[model samples]
Target: MRKNGSNGGRAKYQCAKCGYHGYLQPAAPAARYAQVEKLLAERNSQRSIVRATGVSRMTVANLAKKSAISQPTAAAPAAEISPAQALGST
Candidate 1:
């Protein structure tokens, strides 16, 4: 894939407390995006987000994995058939 400007992949960062080395990420190395996505997906209100995540609405909206598909709820099906169909009367 072609990259525009400086994409700058990964970088090494030193842990201040233990002097351990780790890789810093362009998004988030430890899967913070997954959390952001979960929050966004739950349709939680923006004010509630700030109260909980300490991030603004714009940030929450931006960080979400905007392209993922939402699965239909389990208790209800997208399509349903009559009980007679379930029997052998179709």
Candidate 2:
């Protein structure tokens, strides 16, 4: 592949043999995201997480929202009543 030109302010490359042209997408920062997730799990505030991890506020919020949606919340236990309580006899 060879550099063709700039596309959308990113370097565009073209296949040397096939004539296919496109911009190479950058890889996701997995390590940074892992750090963000760790800080989030530590109960750090979104702003604090952003400061600590150098990730954007929106990114932190999105990760938090995604994790919340993915994890299942435990159901609250139902209250039990004795026969006397059920009869309102205290």
Candidate 3:
């Protein structure tokens, strides 16, 4: 297919399983996660992340947990892997 010369043209997609169709949305979970990681790496605060990325604070907190960010919690020590264990050795 050729471009329609429109500045805001987006590819339309169809789902065969559900018979769903829609234009592709640019912002996605993985993209948001990557952006969050980048911003977090820069030492940005949660509020800053939420404001800049338009992601909710709860979502940011969830992503932080999923990313295994170091947290000073009582359970944190339980999740640590010894050097030998990390190397898959006994």
10 residues in a row with least lDDT, candidate 2 = 23-32
lDDT rank, highest first? 2, 3, 1
By TM-score, is 1 or 3 better? 3
Q: What CA root-mean-square deviation does each model show from the true structure?
A: 10.0, 8.8, 12.8
Worst 10 residues of 1 by lDDT: 1-10
Off by over 4 Å in 3: 1-26, 69-90
Best by TM-score: 2
**lDDT of all predictions:** 0.58, 0.89, 0.76
Query: Given candidate 1, what's the lDDT at residue 44?
Result: 72
Report the C-alpha lDDT of model 1 over 45-88, residue by residue, as the tens digit.
65676677666677765554342445444585457778997797
Query: How would the candidate models be sorted by TM-score, starting from the highest?
Result: 2, 3, 1
Worst-scoring 10-residue span by lDDT in model 3 = 1-10
Candidate 2 — which residues are off by over 4 angstroms?
1-28, 78-90
Model 2 TM-score? Answer: 0.54
Error of 3 at 22 (Å): 10
List pairs with backbone clashes in candidate 1: none
